[model samples]
Target: DAGVTQSPTHLIKTRGQQVTLRCSPKSGHDTVSWYQQALGQGPQFIFQYYEEEERQRGNFPDRFSGHQFPNYSSELNVNALLLGDSALYLCASSVTGGELFFGEGSRLTVL
Candidate 1:
């Protein structure tokens, strides 16, 4: 994905822990979306933000939260982490709910 990237490509955490992952959307894209991909499973939508507002969200619990910046960059924060939270967290960019281009993702492993 052009201009889309994530930080802390890999990380480790423990139960009851919390982590914040960051993403920079593609240039000119006004929306950012987050996804969680467990091993051997397809990505699951976590949430989407635009205009610095959360515009859409998936079925994930309140523990999953995010924010979008004025520059279109974004962040995903997961609190009270569990082993089950281990996954590749992807950040995607689009134009107001248009087609998406995804970053490589940040891998999180919990023990």
Candidate 2:
């Protein structure tokens, strides 16, 4: 039984570029959610996916999007990235009540 895991652990990009982060859900879990956590701030939900469809979404711009696979893994894509986009991108998994179990996150640094 594996918990959620993220790749690259860290990433670097420039303003106006694009970035993608990956996530694998916990075993036996079928829901995935993406969150953005700025330094010294709490995580803000981006979206949630279940059964390969988006079940819920947050107040994010069109530049933020995501995909969930049949295996329950997910990817978060951000376009035309900005320096303000520099934050910890977290992937969380849950069953019900939305009590999220988070991963270590993919840290993005916009230069």
Candidate 3:
């Protein structure tokens, strides 16, 4: 069975640009969460999506946005990207208030 999966396993972007990352949740999951992990640091919660609505968010700036589809897949969009945005973007899926299953993550590099 397929677990969580992310796209563009690795990507590059420049400061002031924009980028979009995608994720597909594991089967039977209805909640999707996003996180950003800097080198040597634990992942920072970015946001969570459920039933096509954003249910929660973290301390990230307004530049970060996300969408959840009825199919339980999601997309993370970062506008006017900054060098500080460089990090591993992780996607996790689970039933609301249940155990989270994480993906390998998509590594984003900003220059």
Please write out the lDDT profile of model 1 over residues 1-111, one tens digit for every residue: 468999989999999999999999898899999999999999999999989999989999999999888888998999999999999999999898588998999999999
Candidate that scores best on TM-score: 3
Candidate 2: list runs displaced more than 4 Å.
none
Models sorted by lDDT, best on top: 3, 1, 2
Cα-based TM-score, every candidate? 0.96, 0.95, 0.99
- Where is model 1 poorest over a 10-residue stretch in terms of lDDT? 1-10
Better of 1 and 3 by TM-score: 3
The parts of candidate 1 lying over 4 Å away from their true place are: none
Question: What is the C-alpha local distance difference test score of candidate 2?
Answer: 0.92
* lDDT value, residue 38 of candidate 2: 97
Residue 83 alpha-carbon offset, candidate 2, angstroms: 0.5
Task: Show where candidate 3 strays beyond 4 Å.
Answer: none
In angstroms, give how far residue 57 of model 2 lies from its true place.
Answer: 1.0
Cα lDDT tens digits for candidate 3, 1-111: 999999989999999999999999999999999999999999999999999999999999999999998899999999999999999999999999999999999999999
